[model samples]
Target chain A: MKKDMRSGFFALIGKAAGIVAVGAGLGLGVNALRADGLSLGATRPTVGDDKSTAGSCSAGPTTNVPEASIDEARALYGKPGVTFVDARSRADFERGHVKGAVLLPYEAAAAAAGQASLPVPTDHRLIVYCEYVNCQLSSLLAQLLSQSGCERVRVLKGGYPAWASAGLPTGTGP
Target chain B: MGERRAANGDGAVSESAATSGVSSSCAVTRFLEGPIVQIAARLALAAIFFYAAIPKIGDPAAFARDIANYRLVPEEMVSPAAVMLPWIELVTALCLALGVLTRGAALVCAVLLAAFTAATTAAVLRGLNIECGCFGQSGSGNAVGWGTVVRDAAFLVPAVLVVLFDRGRYGLAKAIKRP
Candidate 1:
């Protein structure tokens, strides 16, 4: 008989050994990862956030607007006492911003909770804005504001670029 | 007569050498190509991860409560970690299925499963009876027990398979062939 016939027995043994070795190796690896994840137990929460956990999603007095249309924000633009906050990076705010708009980046609000500069008062009607459609920081900021228990929090109808593109009042901020 | 004898010897030697070479190479090739056994293993793992997370994602706070119950995290971060954990699981799972970054993805998954298994083992030995909250609290909480460890170990099998035979049934590389 050809040696190939005997090869089958060796292949079977090889596969069985492969399976066991693989399982044991991964088992050890899982032990290590679990140890690490446990070590990281509290650290996971300190990382990325601002939504879902911000405020109670339902029955939590949230002024959450999943999405805002540009036209809707524009209509709200001139409303008295409505604060249009540009919830974008500082660079975008400096390059140009919506007229009467203020810069309050999302990270800043969360990072500096007690600072006076953040417009995070319980009484203020806050509107966080970002670039435009599909951008998330504005929504995220709005969510944070809601979680922090602001009286009213909303993202701008359209983000900053949308307002600028519409030829609305824009350019520099105090 | 001498020439005929010499030719016969050469022919036999070549035949034996070729047979052994083919036998060795086929086993290696099967491993490289990701035989059906490995494919089944990967698919099994993908299904487990993708579905295990649906309930948790739907109602994250419940999962947060579970995390909090672990008494492991600080008061502040509990909620945020609750929201992000499911997303990480979902993304890693999709990556495993796509076979993109197979090694890294498998390693991460192995890590995750191992973590779960450790928790399961810990719960079992420590006599701390609590809901694993792995799939979420569907309504009533189930007690943590040996079943959870077994379930997690069952899941661990495929992660090991992937790590050992990473080329996969449908991967981007093959073994070096000899002439």
Candidate 2:
């Protein structure tokens, strides 16, 4: 029995090695034919593109939350302790932002531990926003907050521009 | 011992005679289990993985960045993972498609899908609104959420089916062997 098992193990490994060799050959052979060849560790994704024109944010087909309109955001902004988390850079935030909105950018969230630095009140509803409809940061931030156990996470519709255009209040610094 | 051997030989002869008169239903069953069905399954899985591998193989750096977006793998391992993953996909795809080591290839594909399902499930549970990157960079319209997880889960069925049904027939490996 022991000998049989040993032989079986060796046979399986041998077959697996053959399969790997074949796979490597096919992959590399095709890769070598490419115009660019194989480019490893070449570039990183760019941080932000402000030319967003989409109407809504989706985390994916699943875990999508209802979008909060500018009017809804304004209504919620006045209410005590409702968190409006800005998913923009600190530079962007310092230039101009919705009054009382906290800066918890998506790039920051990628590196930081879950909700560790943000002041997320347990009872508050978190409304996240970035640069208009095309900006994915807001959706990503909302998703992160939702993942971090925020029950009422929502993304602001049309993002910061809509709020500003609606003649709502704005702030800057720190 | 000779008497027993003669009796066994007679039993085999009778069994072969019985099987020679196979029913239409039995023939249909055999056809279903034969090369056609196996080949179709192999081609479908191969096409999918091949489509996935092409975009990633050329640009491992971009793929590495996509992997980084998931934050699943460690930073140091990301580069190596990115370089090898597409090649693995391509290899298994070729093996399965060409029927070269078909079962082994199917097993590899099954394992890859299982890993993808786990990763996507983790992302879903984590409330991540991210692209799946299963097929390189996700299109702008497609979000990597629960739908992606379900899709990956669905792809697993064929891989599992191939692994179970492969009998070393209708493949390049078998074709090359002279009868």
Candidate 3:
């Protein structure tokens, strides 16, 4: 009886493994057939890396939305056609943000991408930023903006925290 | 039987009546432990998995972004995980709903729920204010919180019940075996 029970347990495990294998095969196969299929072996580019091809304006895809260095962003600050867009949460935006930056939280912008007019003008050179260096919200928001016909969208390297730490102008509330 | 007991004594007749009462209660217990409960649990798990998986399957890229936001997995693995996880969920859900490979499917569901709960808890602890991504990329507003962790943890109950108590009753497995 004990031996039978043990074998039955193993059989159940085998069945579970089989299910996983089958699912993975289907996933990869279907993904390969799709037009928008992801390259499983390729690494996604880190947004702010200076050496990353993602920073090049001519990079092939929306995923390669260009990034602006802190110095570049500072220079463009308060320029006539430049707009700073905060891509963090509303709470985070309220806590502290780039001086004169408009709140366009990534989640809200993503949901309203094609349907609604973006908070920032599409004709403006939009500089997006989130919380910190590792935060992907800025890049993600830039992609959305780029797709939404905002031609000059760029992620701000090191995000708002970096700007603040560097003693650049900052603001709080709404 | 009541008449037979009555012939012995009044006290014996009462005991016989009590025995019948106990037997009726046992029937109720059996009903509660039977296929109805198992089927209900299985269907609930299947529905949740289906709802969660379909959106992710449709847009793996957005799902990949959501996973990257978690900051848990390495960057390269994010795409592959995003590509495969929804399909696994979908297959597991199908198995659960159809009652084919019910035990294995339930076990997988339990494990997935446990993993989600752990990931959400970790995010909450680290104060990473990100989307839960429990459902999919459309879950933009569904921020990760301790409440999200509790909800995922709560889902484990049905998954586990399906694992331990499901006997393929009223399922495709049982129907296939009928001669």
Candidate 4:
């Protein structure tokens, strides 16, 4: 029994090491390949050429899906299939918010998203907005949501400030 | 008497094997006995990847530009990575969450997180102020780095854990029944 145990331990250790090495190697190879030069890709994604396009922010493919234009989102304001995540403090959310937006404070966004019970369907669009761009909360919140599996998540550029500044309707806090 | 001695040796070998296997088998059994936490961990890891990759997948050029900002990878691999990595993440995350090919999916995640760690480390060491591009950054170009490392490390823990002990909890691939 002890002998068998010794062999099993060695085998497990060997397999674990091999797995780590292979995993790390793949990482470095990808990194090294990108380090070689990065001008062309298999297919360049289409984007708004104007870097200054309002109501639009770049969504990295791996992180989150691209959001709709403000105009498009306007139609989705309270619509189904669009999960509006309010990335603000609980107190602030209680002050005012958009209709149908869930109260997922930036600090709590990760924990909120970690749950499998949250009804936000995997196929729905996820939009995260915070008080303002200078706030630094929304960027983190958006990323957290994406990291947590919100497939089509978008950070409202300049966040809630832009929306309020644009005179969009604000909902009463819960 | 010679046959008896040989039998005694065989018994010793079997005893050693039993001792070793017992410990590991106990752990595996313990997990199989109560796998709720393991299931949660796998799902959590899957969620993070899905979230991380979706934004980058959407605007690959933005992702490419963010990758470029790091100055870790060469200019060439950037675009392909931008294009494929997200899809890989999306698929892997899906596989993990759905409980399909859990082990394979976890391995893919470990690979992604490990790459992220290296790239983030390289960028920081070189003093690049670039955004990690795990989430595509805006054209603002301010550079985002350190946080990337921390986030990747955070993800790495769970991914590695799953690779180590999690076989399949909630999704289609039950350890007793690998997808």
Best of the candidates, lDDT: 3
After superposing candidate 1, which stretches have Cα over 4 Å from the reference? A1-174, B1-33, B168-179
Kindly give the number of clashing pairs for every candidate. Answer: 3, 2, 0, 61
- Candidate 1 DockQ vs. native: 0.02
Runs in model 3 deviating more than 4 A are: A46-82, A85-126, A130-174, B1-33
Please report how far candidate 3 places residue A144 from its true position, in Å. 14
Q: Is candidate 1 or candidate 3 better by DockQ?
A: 3
Sorted on TM-score, best first, the list reads 3, 2, 4, 1
Q: Highest DockQ: give the candidate number.
A: 3
Model 3 chain B: which ten-residue window has the lowest total lDDT?
Answer: B3-12
Please tell me which predicted candidate would have the highest TM-score against the true structure.
3
RMSD of 2: 12.7
Segments in model 4 whose C-alpha atoms lie over 4 Å from true places: A1-174, B1-34, B137-145, B175-179
Worst 10 residues of 4 chain B by lDDT: B1-10
**Residue-level lDDT tens digits of model 4 in A1-174:** 999979855664554444444434444455456533334532222232212211122322344335445566676776768777787666767777766778776545434433333434546777777653433455556565455444577766556656766687778858
- Each model's TM-score? 0.41, 0.52, 0.66, 0.44
Candidate 1: residue A90 Cα off by (Å): 47
- Per-residue alpha-carbon lDDT of model 1 for A1-119, expressed as tens digits? 56885884455445434433444454334434542222223422222343333322222445545454667667777687666778776776877787777787766765664343354
Clashing pairs for model 3 are none
| B-chain TM-score for every candidate | 0.72, 0.79, 0.82, 0.74
State which docking tier applies to candidate 4. incorrect
Per-residue C-alpha lDDT of model 4 across residues B13-76, encoded as one tens digit per residue = 3454556566778977676434665687688988887887777655665676566556566656
